[model samples]
Target: MIKNIIFDFGDVFINLDKPATVNQLSKLDSSFCVSGKMNEINEAYEKGLIATDAFVSFYKSKFPAINEASLINAWNAIILDLPEYRLSFLEQLANEKKYRLFLLSNTNELHIEHVINTCGSDTFNRFKDCFEKFYLSYEIRYRKPDPEIYKYVLSENKLNPEETLFIDDVKENTDAASALRIKTWNLKPGIDDVTMLKDQTCFG
Candidate 1:
């Protein structure tokens, strides 16, 4: 029986245009591609190994033509809408207290700031209230698909892997969780809305 539920915050909850940043950056430089040291810098930033100022400075230095605001905008373009229905569903689930609910997300500072600005503090706080534990990659200094992170969640919460269900949009992330004996739902964005989670037999 599943006693705990872990959810990915990106596509599983908030709508994200995963390719928007890449496409947007390419417009600034036709030859722009996330490569070499760029990938390293991004990983470090995501892991909270670097400060936001350093991250912005690196991009500004690389793309001198792009102003700080423009660069931040392009970087944050991937974040999109968070539907009310999904929030409602989560709230209902939380109130029921049938499962231990947690949120695990691989996110950075700028994107989180964008979410707060776009979603407003009250709305975001309500959403956050629905989870027992909220794990942000940068804050936690750990990310998904890294077994250690999953281990940390389980160990910290004293959760049994066999009694936990991990839900994420990325197959690789779900796969990693599965390796640790956790059940998972690799939800498809358009077709598998989280509001319809009850339809899945696994929840039953």
Candidate 2:
């Protein structure tokens, strides 16, 4: 029986415009789209190895033609508007108390700051209140696809791996959780909805 539900924030709950980010950056630095520098920079930033200011400054230096504001905007272009339907679904899930709910995301400071700004402080707070624990990669010093992070969450919550349902849009993250024997949902962005699980008798 799945007694715990773990969710990934981006794409699972919020949408991301991956291509737009690459396209915008490519216009400034032709290398960004071809090379994996953007992904490398983001990985470094998400792990807290690089500070937000430092990352932005580094990006600005690399792409001199683009101004700081536009560069920053492009970096944050992955973030998309939160839907009210998702919010309502989360609220309902919390109220039911049918399962222990958790949120885990590989996010950095700038992305979070922009999410707070775009979603409104009140909405962010409300969303957070729905979770028993909200785990962030930067705060936790560990990111997904790393088994240690999943183990840490399970150990911290005292949850049995078999009793947990891990939901993420990324395949690698779910693969890590499955390796630990936790049930997982590798949701397709823009196509799958997390709330659909609530209707499935197999979920809870």
Candidate 3:
């Protein structure tokens, strides 16, 4: 029986366009592209190795044509929307107390700030309240697909791998969790929805 559930943020609970950032940035300046180094910078930033100001400064220095606001806007273009029905479903799960719930996502400060601004504090807080623990990459200094992060969560919470189920839109992430003996649902963005967890056959 699955007694614990770990969920990914983007494309799972909230709708997202993974390539939205690059597309949006290209509009601001054709030269503003995520080069190899920026990819590394992104990983570092998500892992909390780099501070928010420093991260933004790196972008400003790299792309002097665009102002900070525009850069931030393009960066946040990935976060699309969260459906109210999903929130209602999650709240029902939280209220039932049937399983310990958690949120884990590889995200940075800027994107999160945008999420707060877009969702409004009340809705965001209420959604957050549903989770027993809300873990973000920047705040936790750990991102998914990394063995350490999963181990940290499992060990810290004293959760059994067999009893825990992880849900992520990325197959790579779900594969990593599965390797650790944790059950997983490789959720499909458009075809699968988190709100259908109970109805889904994967849970069994």
Candidate 4:
């Protein structure tokens, strides 16, 4: 019956330029590579293992050419605006109270800070108020497509896997949820929008 719904934040509700960070970094340091060491640090930062200052410091130390302000700016280049229509849809869905709603996002401190700065805290809270439970990777210290994060959410909320639907823009994330018997829609960003929920077969 889909008693519960889990939604991903980036690309689902908010617009994102996924390649913007890498592109921005490359511009700062001509030899920049999103490889090995940065991947490890990035994953750790997302999981809350590393603090924000330390994160920026790592980049500054590695590149040596980029300062803290520019480095922070480059790192946050991937995040974009939260479309008003999506928020309107989410608010309508939440107000209906037909199903338990949740937000599960793999995000970091710098990006979130930028979002808050751009959107304003009150506006961000308005978006958050739509969800029954809001889970951020950095706050929870767990990120997807890890099985643990999904399991934690299911267990914490006492949600039945069969009655839950998880929507994500990433196939690997959706696949992980499906493995746990949770229904999923691997939504395509430009081709499919979250506001088209009623059109999905899972919604039936």
Candidate 5:
């Protein structure tokens, strides 16, 4: 009996070109890989441990040839379209009020800004209004696959792990949630659409 639903924003709802940023950056620096100090800096930024300007500055310092605009564009290139059908499904779910709905996403400021700018304020607001609690990684200073963040969400909402279902595109994230006794759907991007929730037995 699932009484609450937790969702991942990317892939599960909004589409993302997960490899676009890497590809774009690789063009700028042939040896650029998501490793070493870069990964640490990204984690720090996602955790809201650093400001947006600091993040941009760090990249600027590393890739002097790349201008701020180019860096920002490459960083945000991963964000793509948010299909209307998904939004419609979410809006319907919200209206039904059958269960507590929440959004937990590992996102940064620039990406969020891109989403707002691309999706338009009214559409974005509609999507936001669907959630009872919207947890942004940067804003919350917590991220997925970190058990503490899941614990915090459960504790704050007074939700029972047994009665909650978390849906995410990442297996690692879903695995972490499952470790806490929360049911999860590790949805495959192309094969599993969020709009097809009724097909999932957990929801049934």
Candidate 6:
């Protein structure tokens, strides 16, 4: 029986349009995509290899012609607001205490700041209180697709791997967790809904 559930924060919970940000950045500077600077900056930012300020500085330095405000806007274009229905679902699950719920996201400070601003501090706080443990890659210094991150969660919680269900939008992240014998759900966009999880027998 699944005794724990791991939720992914991005597309699995809050909708994120990856291409929208890339397209916006491309509009800011055609050279961003052409020069491959955007990819370099994002890779460094997401991996926690660079601080938010340093990441912004690196982008600004590369595109010295572009203003800092525009660069900041382009960088922050990824985050979208959290819907109310999803928030209610999470609240219900937490109240029920159906399983030990945890949230694991491969996120950074800037993106989180954007999320907080978009979702509002009160709502974000309410959402946060629902989880037994919350894990963010930047804060933890360990990212998804890295086995160590999953291992860290399991070890920190003292959870039995076989009794835990890990859900994520990305296949690679779930695959990593599954390797450790954790039951996983690779939530597909528009295909999987967290609220619908209650109807499934797989989860207790």
Give lDDT tens digits, candidate 2, residues 129-161. Answer: 999999989888789989999999999999999
User: Worst lDDT window (10 residues) for model 6?
Assistant: 32-41
TM-score of each: 0.97, 0.93, 0.97, 0.98, 0.97, 0.93
**What do the candidate models score in CA lDDT, each in turn?**
0.92, 0.87, 0.91, 0.94, 0.93, 0.84
Alpha carbon deviation, residue 102, candidate 2 (Å): 0.6
Q: By lDDT, rank the candidates, best first.
A: 4, 5, 1, 3, 2, 6
Q: Model 1, stretches more than 4 Å misplaced?
A: none
Each prediction's RMSD over C-alphas, in Å, is: 1.0, 1.6, 1.0, 0.7, 0.9, 1.8
After superposition, the stretches of candidate 2 with alpha carbons farther than 4 Å from their true spots are 34-38, 200-204
Error of 3 at 82 (Å): 1.4
Candidate 4: list runs displaced more than 4 Å.
none
Off by over 4 Å in 3: none
Candidate 4 lDDT, 87-200, residue by residue in tens: 999999999999999999999888888999988898899999999999999999999999999999999999999999999999999999999999999999999999999889
Task: State residue 63's C-alpha deviation in candidate 5, in Å.
Answer: 0.7
What would the per-residue lDDT of candidate 1 be over residues 1-204, giving only the tens digit for each residue?
889999999999899999999899899878777878998898889889999999999998998988898889899999998889899899999999999999999989999999988888898998999999999999999988899999999999999999999999999999999999998899999989888787887676
Task: Score candidate 3 by TM-score against the native.
Answer: 0.97
Candidate 6 matches the true fold with a TM-score of 0.93
